[model samples]
Target chain A: MRGVSLATPYLHIDLPQLRINVRRAADQAALVGVALRPHAKTHKSAEVARLQLAHGAVGLTVATVGEAEHFVRQGCRDVFIAFPVWVDEGRATRLRDLRDQADRLAIGVDSVESAGNAGRRLGHTGIEVLVEVDSGHHRTGVAPEQAGVVARAAQRAGLPVRGVFTFPGHGYGPGGSEAAAHDERTALETARDSIQQVGIEEPVLSGGSTPTLAASLTSRAATELRPGVYVFGDAQQWELGIFEPDDISLTVHATVVSHAGGRVVLDAGSKTLGADRAAYSSGYGRLLEHPEARIVTLSEHHAVVQMPGPRPALGSLVSVVPNHVCSAVNLADTFWVAEPGGLRAWPVGARGLHT
Target chain B: MRGVSLATPYLHIDLPQLRINVRRAADQAALVGVALRPHAKTHKSAEVARLQLAHGAVGLTVATVGEAEHFVRQGCRDVFIAFPVWVDEGRATRLRDLRDQADRLAIGVDSVESAGNAGRRLGHTGIEVLVEVDSGHHRTGVAPEQAGVVARAAQRAGLPVRGVFTFPGHGYGPGGSEAAAHDERTALETARDSIQQVGIEEPVLSGGSTPTLAASLTSRAATELRPGVYVFGDAQQWELGIFEPDDISLTVHATVVSHAGGRVVLDAGSKTLGADRAAYSSGYGRLLEHPEARIVTLSEHHAVVQMPGPRPALGSLVSVVPNHVCSAVNLADTFWVAEPGGLRAWPVGARGLHT
Candidate 1:
């Protein structure tokens, strides 16, 4: 594209590939009769959100209230904050305004104390609260049986107990998706049954991760799926066998600024490509054009790539598929979308919304 | 302090401590009879740059041309881009404009090919070009012996050969600073000889890294030092004995949103604290209040903290000193400076100047 030569480090998103990925994920969720509430935390672009919605996404899932606010302002009516938010007075005020703006809004609650805080602050506001149940990730969430306790606390505090959700984050590791999805199903099922036993029925169970999306089809209790990074396959997904190299929709276009010996330095570094590193990642990222090259080290503004035999000349542009595409996208201010003959710049709408 | 309840994952920089760190680095540079050119890549704030200049910084050192442009636009009279830049026609045109704006503007060129490119593009502009020599960090830079070859090439192409510069980046690892500084001296001295043998004399040899700045005093060849992280000490510096716990000026203020057993999940994550993991890091970062706490894992929006014995209550605030302060600062839009009355927000002026 014409814009490819404008800068050393720029994010490029293949519009066609991105659309295909979105359609495929939506189709996969449809096949299982589950609503596809694609996580907007990955792209953080309202444009990408619209694409997902057009591809049959029911609503959108977000990680923070800031993200929810961004999407809600962009005309997304239904939104869910997927994290166990600690809603203080300030957040409660924002939630109230968001509820007034959006048609439907939901938040996650894993503890009775936090649920009480949210309920007391948001009492009689009709804000939907989902009990987050720990499936296998052990990051945040209550035990499957403990979901009923949290839901009851929310109910007592006058907040509506809508459903339960779990993130099979352990699916990220090598070949861990199958078992994580199984744990996700069992946990969601137990959470749903426990809530039902406590007079809470018709709970909408939600579960899915990019790595375990295919396996989520087997989740009998989960009513919806929320996969974030499937929209833009990264080096982690490719290395983990979740996505093929051809499936990567986003890549950072970087210039080889320095060529010495077998190593080359790119203008892109941690600030541009993100510092997200996985245990299984080969390096910081993979050079798309030169498969044999590995970005061995990254400072704030320099990525040092080591090549096996033939290294690209200095000033040559190389596309890098980041190890984690979500964090990478969050770092950039704009994404260059491939168009007919040129690239169109789209602002990263929800960047730095870390509240 | 009131703002602590407003945002969960906000960056807090102690103004008093930051001033102290600036003064100390300047004093150290003065003691060693070297000009202090603090790297702006760490904070990316023009306000911070003014602080460094006030504390006797002769000029500013940047990692990219965009960073140089950002600071120059903010009235930085002198700037040096430390990375070996690949100046194509567009960048060269920008460089000429930058050269006109600043009293002195310099760029690094490590290879003859790159030197030729820069020389051809930037010839007759009186723009300074420093040959980058590799000390110990195998990331970038030419060998000490290759410095003359590149400098000669630049001279032959009508570009002024200023001197050689080396980054003691190998100083980052555990107990590597002293040796890396020693290597930096040897490399720069050898590079000086290599250039002088080819008729280049009185070369303004420059070298420094936060970890090796103290040891740079032993380097008789280094005429100036560029230490970026000395402005905001991090967990890596504390772990490496580069600074004490009291010296950490910047910290990520995060709230514990979930309490699950002994581990609590904070709203801060890789997006807030940065995912710069070191082999010597205790975890992702160190907590200022709870010294025994370790941020064990990070998703994009959640930091899982493993505490010993006691843990903070849910919704309580905690200060986290990141593993790498530079990367952490890059993620935030504003730095909340602690004042006598309250915290004041300062925009990160050049946060994403990665070009």
Candidate 2:
């Protein structure tokens, strides 16, 4: 509390809690006989990725070719770009550069167009292409039946097809992870059957979220798990029963700048907590200390909280639980990680490197 | 749009529109016989500050000591930090350094605590302190009656009492700026009279916002205007009728990544458009060309836009009108100014320098 100086608002990571979360995830993945490929996009820090690797993560998952390039530059060898990539002229060049640097580079291909593009971009490069199958989350990925067609297209284009992958994003709601993992098993199995029916052997089937990773291992269809936000549990994870409050690793450390009209405004705002409120989200996010306090609104530099109990005095430092950890990490330039005995700064290495 | 790849997800500033906005604000302030002190927090570009100065800005206003330092480094002569700064030991050192650099430096003081802190830190440096009066926006500042008390407190602490400044931020809503400006005038006049009754002549009375500037001029109580966001009018300003779409000087150039289910996802996401959304905001923001298309949601690197009509094809480029241009600027590493013939990159000189 004494060291709470008013600087730019930032997310603080409790290393003890983060290590526990990582161990729990690794243990769960091992129990299910699947490898954990923690998504580096969540933290985007080489330091956190190192922790995941130390905890038995086989590889790391990234969202973009730029992110893959960044992590690989930071000495990460195996990187999977989990998002369905559409390789245009500029992106194709960048993807080639990333593929050359990474030890094992795999990209998600959800459509014939993307498959063809990847095939064209990764000519003679031996880049692995994962058929993205929709397991419930309709944001991306092809239908389970269409996965084989996309896989065949990739194979025909001279790219090696690496089974299938699906994101159980639907598992993030109340009692949704188990059902989502069930859906993932069904989708991945169907896709695998379709690929075999075409005389192609699928090598990998990956699916998992923090909530679904435990349940997903019940199915032999999944060979690997890619859970990103699990490394830094957030308010949404806590609300969805994916994590306990003690399991929450990341929090926004902010000072109360003003307290009036039963509302307290903290120096942390959308720039730190991020704007990732779902319809079921209690509010903007949760407070670590005062769970009853709801973040009613967030401006650029102020998070307005309606205190259910006693208001924190002006200048009081409070920890905020962001609704989504990944987005929050992107908002910050760097994060302070309090490892057991020391504090260190980790640059959100790939933040805003969307290009 | 060939050869117009002005860098994806970067702010595109139209010099023509920006010059017009500056001239218009200056003409309005001149007509009202009030000096204009354009707040640099919106752009944070010294180049823009110079433009405002050339367009007749008497001085410049900033939100933080960091911004004041930045402006002073850019050779700005007069700078006023409009926020009530709580100076600690380290910041006190910075404040002293800033005082040495600037020809005229002033900071807002709304509480006795801050006044005492500033006085103690300043140590007879003769730093000018302006009492921040709460006209309506309850975010910060003291009540109108408390302005005199705070000024006297500053005087007692040996800090030079300059005058009163109030931001009619609440005036940003629908048909609210005019009423808010009226309230600002009444509050400042009452506070000035109170200070005068105590035999102290308040030197300056400042109040302004893009929405309230016109109304504020009707009241002669305010002698200076501080409008920041008008230089790059955003979707919020357009919706509030504060500025027309043509008056919008800045835009986010993003590429369409996916088009499916009557929705088009752009590469911009929250990192480019920013996560700032008011209750009255149409959606996250606006698409410059596709006005009917509403940005329904944003993840870290993907913006899901629900098209009102036909969806754009993938790989198509688009310009987004962010809800708040200031936040969008903060999210980017650099901005591109599209001049007559070519594009020039300007490092968001003060980005992530917030303290």
On a 0 to 1 DockQ scale, where is model 1?
0.68
| After superposition, candidate 2 runs with Cα above 4 Å error | A1-8, A217-221, A260-263, A308-310, A339-342, B1-7, B218-221
lDDT for model 1, please: 0.90
Best by DockQ: 1
Candidate 2 chain B lDDT trough over 10 residues, lowest sum: B1-10
True contacts kept of 1: 0.67
Using Cα atoms, each model's DockQ against the true complex is: 0.68, 0.36
Q: Write the per-residue lDDT of candidate 1 for residues B1-355, one digit (tens) a residue.
A: 5742557789998898999999988887788789888899999999999999988898999988899999999989999999888898778888999999999999999899999999999987999899999998887889999899999999998889889999989898888999999999999989999999879879989999899998897565699888899999999998899999899999999888998654689999888888898878889999998888888888888889888786788989999999999999888899998888788889998987888
Q: B1-355 in candidate 2: lDDT tens per residue? A: 3443433667899988899999988887888789999988788888899999998898899877777888899988899988767676667888889889888888987777768778888857867988888788876677788777878878888888878898888897988988999999988888787666555775688888888887887787799989989999999998889888888999998877665333577778776787777778889889889777788877666788887667777667888999988888877777788877688777777666556
Candidate 2 chain A lDDT trough over 10 residues, lowest sum: A1-10
Q: Name the best candidate (by lDDT).
A: 1
Error of 2 at A254 (Å): 2.0
The positional error of residue B257 in candidate 2, measured at the CA in angstroms, is 1.8
Local error of candidate 2 at residue A235 (angstroms): 2.6
